[model samples]
Structures are given as structure tokens and as C-alpha cells.
Target: MSPEYAIEGAFSIKSDVYGFGVLMIEIVTGKKNRFFTHPDHNLNLLGHTWKSYNEDRLSELIDASILESSDQDEVFRVIAIGLLCVQQYPEDRPTMSSVMKMLTSNITLPRPKQPGFFTERKLEEADTSHSMLCLSSSNHSITTLAPR
Candidate 1:
């Protein structure tokens, strides 16, 4: 669930891209994004990845099992593309076709902006078991009776 769809109930192809991005990160790290935890930080896997990438510490995020078998540069590029997919806005993500080309080509990859869902969550504010969305609570009342 991309942040937009999760919070606003708006869905699009970009929503799937966000999902794919999460998949990519999990594949590379061998950790589930939702359940991933770090000893020093409360960042989810996606947030951790964003922080690692920015710090040029992506090497720390790769699965050691895959590291030996995979080309480091290629893996880094995939991670970068994954980051691009999970950017803060759906409009910022590339189309699926563009993603494919990026994966296959050596073209210069754009620097990804901050990722969505990268913030430390306040679990108390919402029911984490059902949803992480924090929609504002409001009430409505009928001031007058209407016959319609």
C-alpha cells in the first residue's frame, strides 16, 4: 500500500510501482520491510534503506548471501531504482516501461528524492494492526431535518 492509497484511498499504476519498490528492497536485504527493525533506529526497512543510500552506506543493506553471487554495482543500481519507485509522490515515480529500461540499461539514474513511509511512525496514533494511515477524526451533525 503506497502512502497515497493508504491515506487518501487514491490508487494508480504508481501505487503498484511503490509496491514493487518495497519488493525490490526486501529481495535485496532479505528482510521484510514491514517487520524489519534496526537495533539503533526505529526506521522501517524502506526508511533504513533511504538513510543508507544517502549516506553511501548501501553496502550495509545488501544481504550477505547475495553479495557474494551478485555484482555490487548492479545491485546498487537496482536499489537506487527501487528508491526511485518509492519516492514521496506517485508523480515522481517512473512508469513501468521506464523502470524496465533503467534496469536493463546503464543510463544515468536520477537521484531519488526522499521516499514515502520513511518517517518514524507513532504507533499510538493509529491502529497499526489494521492500518498506519492517520486520517483526521471529525464528526458531522444534521442541524435541520430535510425531506429529499
Candidate 2:
């Protein structure tokens, strides 16, 4: 939603893609990707899923809590939809309408490419960049707000 990444007048379809990916992760893991951390590298849920997927361990992305609530076929379908939402190229991502159909129907989905910020290394860099400016501005605000 930040202007830094805006494609047009407002946050574009790609932004929705990011949101869909987050929702998918949340649905599978019963966890929020923003705050979920991995035991190994302290990576967030998205990074953890990407790592697992890369290693051909897709089932690892699923949460035990959802085992009863989730249908295996539906789970796989949603996972594929999520991956489509997070594709690096905006053009490759499906619109919300397409996403809805993909989720509800038995349509064959396109394979998703490596997602943006999929790797821990890339995610770390993105996290650093995203926070650096905000932190610096907040510090400045604190100094200005305090008695001099």
C-alpha cells in the first residue's frame, strides 16, 4: 500500500497478490506471515514456506491445527492460488475474479514462478530497507516531540 511500490494511482493488483499470499499462509499455518518466525533462521512464515517448497517439502507448510478443518485437495488448491498471487511478475498474477474461480472450480492453475522476496536473503534485505527509513523518521519525530 505504500507509495514506494505503487504501480498506478493506488496500490495495484500486485498488492492484492501480496495479500492473497498472506491469506494463504495464514489459512494453512493458522499463523500470520508477518509475525510468524521459523525456528531455524528466524524467517517469517512466507520465507519458511518458500524454503520448504524449494526443498520439495510442500506438506511442511501445512499446520496441524488445520488438519481436521482443511480438505487435502482444497488445501493444495489454495496453496497454488497463493503462489499465483505472489508471483514476481505482476502480469503473471491472476485477478481477483480469476482467483475466485481458481479456488472454487477444478480448473488447472498455471505454475507460479519464484516469488519476489521468496528467499531469506532477499527478505532480510527487503525488511531492512522497509524499516530503515521508517525507523529513522520515527527517531526524528521522537527528538522533535521531546523537550529540547
Best by TM-score: 1
- As for model 2, its CA RMSD to the true structure in angstroms is 6.7
Model 2 reaches what TM-score against the true structure? 0.68
**Alpha-carbon error at 34 in model 1, in Å?**
0.7
Instruction: List clashing residue pairs in candidate 2.
Output: none
Badly placed stretches (over 4 Å) of model 2 are: 1-10, 119-148
lDDT of 1: 0.87
Worst 10 residues of 2 by lDDT: 1-10
Per-residue error for 91 in candidate 1, Å, reads 0.8
Query: What is the number of residue pairs that collide in model 1?
Result: 0
lDDT per residue for candidate 1 within 1-148, as digits (tens), equals: 8999987778977999999998999999999876677777778889999999999999899999888899999999999999999988999999989999999999999999999999775444323632532333346443765543
Clashes of each: 0, 0
Task: Compute the lDDT of residue 31 as modeled in candidate 1.
Answer: 93
RMSD of candidates 1 onward, in order = 7.5, 6.7
Off-target runs (Cα >4 Å) in candidate 1 are 122-148
